[model samples]
Target: MVRSDSAGNGGDAMKEHCGVLAIYSMENRPVAERIVKGLAALQHRGQESWGIAVPGEPILKGLGLIGQGADANAKKILSFTSNRGIGHVRYSTRGRTTLENAHPLDIRGEFAIAQNGTIANTEDLESVVEKEFPILGSTTDTKLAGYRLLQHYRAEHDWTRAFHKLSKELSGSYSFVMITHDGEVLAARDEAGYRPLCLGYDPDTDTHIVASESCALTALHADLVRDVQPGELVSLTKDGLKITKFAAASRHYHCPFEYTYFGHPSSKIDDHYVYNARRKLGRVLARKYPFKADVVIPVPDSARPAALGYSEESGIPMEEGLMKDRYRRKGSLRSFIEPTAKSREEIVREIITIKPVVDGKDVIVVDDSIVRGTSSRNIVQSLRDAGAKKVYMVVTFPPIRHPCYMGIDFPTREELLANKADGETLNVTDLNSKVAREIGVDGLGYNDINGLSEGIGLGKDEMCFACVTGEYLGLKKDPVLRTREEMKA
Candidate 1:
């Protein structure tokens, strides 16, 4: 429903959910610039709007890239002298794209919150507030949650107790970082573990960092500490880090897509290399769904590593099928930003170009995942028009059936193609049978969930598969959207 006219063709140009970065320094050293650079390392996750929360000052946020210009906003943020700070880059999933929805959301006298996942029960929570406290701003569920936290703290006057109480009542996936007026920095991960959060430390400076991925820490020359366990709350203060368990810890469900697409290449997730995991996915796809192809071509950035693995395992030559314009602005143009469906179709054509090596030969196209099937459809059609003898579509991960509430910009069941079809009928069963009926290829295949986890060197129990499995780990109630059908009066 949201539309824009710009056309984005870069590798990292797609929609990301959000990214969070927080730092606690023991030496009171200047870290705003370092924080900004560290966030630049995580810019791949979200680019729509960015903000930094500094102690004893107003939160700084605006619409632009992090490492650009010497403007007032940048000067204001860089000038802030704080030993502790939090930064956020957001991609709107629950709320509209506006300055109000931008994170590091502050409740004047109470707390400033920066979040990285969707609050699934936002509507229900908002309903509770509409019936209880006086409403403040827009209909965004994020602000609603912030208000609830503030209201709870005001009544209880205990930050820890209020956080625990509110965590119990909220439903959906979220990893939150909050700074209280009392100078305590609190971080909490969702029980489902739908999103990734980790802690790292710079022993040299005695500074601790929390970010969406391990790569950010590496960029800041910080040592990798343990991941923030699900259902656990970590508080960073002058006395050092103190962790407390709130809700019963659920089975860890690290989103499988993180390795395949979202995470940076150099990053290590759950002790596994993201690039290596993707390559293993390719290898698994080749073994599970072996297809005779003359050459393997990746869909672009996210699929490149996996495609190489497929080529290595299958002994097929890998070719650079599509070229990306790296200079493209991060948030300026996007495939989904096309104003109309026809324009969206045309934008894909202008962006991708097939190599001449595929002419009169079978081609295997590897992509990270397919949500609505529109992008895949167009890619296949373009490859066919390039004179390929046959086009086979291979996705690195299994079909994404359930909408992701933990973050990743996948909202509403109506937009998911897998949700409409049963598992048995999916391409993995009869690749040719389904591909003949579907657009863009003679066959389509995907890596099995188990195979993907194995390839990543982790067990299903350790990673988040809720987007693929629909089995949320911790919350007792379903998301507000899912419960809407049953809520009818």
Candidate 2:
């Protein structure tokens, strides 16, 4: 368990939810090693803690990166031969980052479950479960949900029926994978589809694979079947694959942030490849905000494709103005995990080295989005110090004003840049000016909500922009921004 008494800085950007993977092998073989490889590909989604659960074997889990987290106990589960298994890589959003809160949480040693997304009514559901099962250990929603499922299974005696009943009582975002005591693998997504989940098939061994992103399937050489539809339940056994509609998709709010930042560039979500979607966002930004600059530079990894699209559309030459120290990538995680302010700034400075290409040249910087404006501010200051004549900031997503309630980490308005703007009414130009002034940039431009829809090739109704427009789809009440103190209470 990695315990920290320090509270985090306000400017830290949104964090991703957990990544889930489950495999059902037709041949009688252990799948824990393959699960590790697939999880390695999805490691970007989480870094705090990870776990793998094989039925009839002691779970393997620990804190920190996957390789560093697992110890000798890992081999006990890895060597155990099981036809079915489930794995999870987690970055805590709802609970403390500790071994006790890690995934593959078992429900009375009957079912093992791993989940991505926050359960909005976690406490209420826990209260409901305590009426029957009095003993509970962890504070994570995965544990609460698992106990609820166990309660349903005991009464209904059917997995599908139990899942259907569980679906009606739950709210908020979730994409879950589970392994039963008898070697059955099950998966499902919430009604609104605020998170991503998909199914795939392996041809070599005729195994079935399910994961949070399509990239995980690609990592294992599996062919993607389709995205598990919102409110759908999927089960895999030695017999075959069975999918059932547990609940109708009331309002589909596939997270737009997945394309903007969270998801891998190569992964496809809801029929759109994230890399192409980001490139389209850049093209739209260039057309909307035409800036005169000698060169364009991306903020690195996530913003690279968008910068390429901006350069192509604006006819401005794109250059690598900053060389990211590949070895320093691990240090970047400290910016998000460390609770102190000074450590965050120091990590940002160590990650990217300024190149002389932008010296005496007007530079245009393309970034995915600005959450707290910390990274963008640091990048802008670095550019100015490197002799860049002027710096202009172009963002792919619209200004985020409200906090996200689904599964994103920035759940409070105090951590948002657009919250600094003057009125409740959303004013793009006003918000842009305020953000530019705060980040110490000469000018700033953001994609409009409509433009984001057009670029991503989805209608405004098909995707969730609640963080930017404050139009929630499935939530009951307006999301309140709670401080860390309030969260502790």
TM-score, structure 1 vs. true: 0.87
Per-candidate Cα RMSD to the true structure, in Å, reads: 6.0, 4.5
> Please, what is the whole-model Cα lDDT of each candidate in the order they appear?
0.72, 0.78
lDDT of 1 by residue, 1-489 (tens): 111111211121112357888888888887777778788888777766777777777766765456552154676766877888788877654323555556677764467778887666665666666666554523445556777877788789866677677888777667888777766778888766767888899999999898889999999999988888777788888999888876655466677878888888788876778999999899998998799999999977788899999999999999987655455432133444232346445546554556596778899989888776677787787777778889887888787777666676665565666655454345566533454345557888867778888788888777767667776664557654543233211
TM-score to native of every candidate shown: 0.87, 0.92
- Pairs clashing in candidate 2? none
Residue range 1-489, candidate 2, lDDT tens digits: 111121221111223268999998887667877788788778878888888887767667777777665544465655767777888998865345666667777666677788888776665676888787765522566667778888888999988788888887776788989887787889999878888999989989888899999999999999988999998989988887899888776568888888888888999988889999999999999999899999999887788899999999999998888655657654545344333346457666765646577889899999988877788899898999889998999999888887777887666677677776642475788778888999998889988888889778888888888888777667644455577556545
Which has the greatest TM-score? 2
What residue runs in model 2 are displaced by over 4 Å at the alpha carbon?
A: 1-16, 70-74, 329-346, 476-481
- Candidate 1's C-alpha runs over 4 A off are 1-16, 68-72, 130-132, 155-158, 328-350, 420-427, 469-474, 482-489
Pairs that clash in candidate 1:
253-463, 253-464, 254-463, 254-464
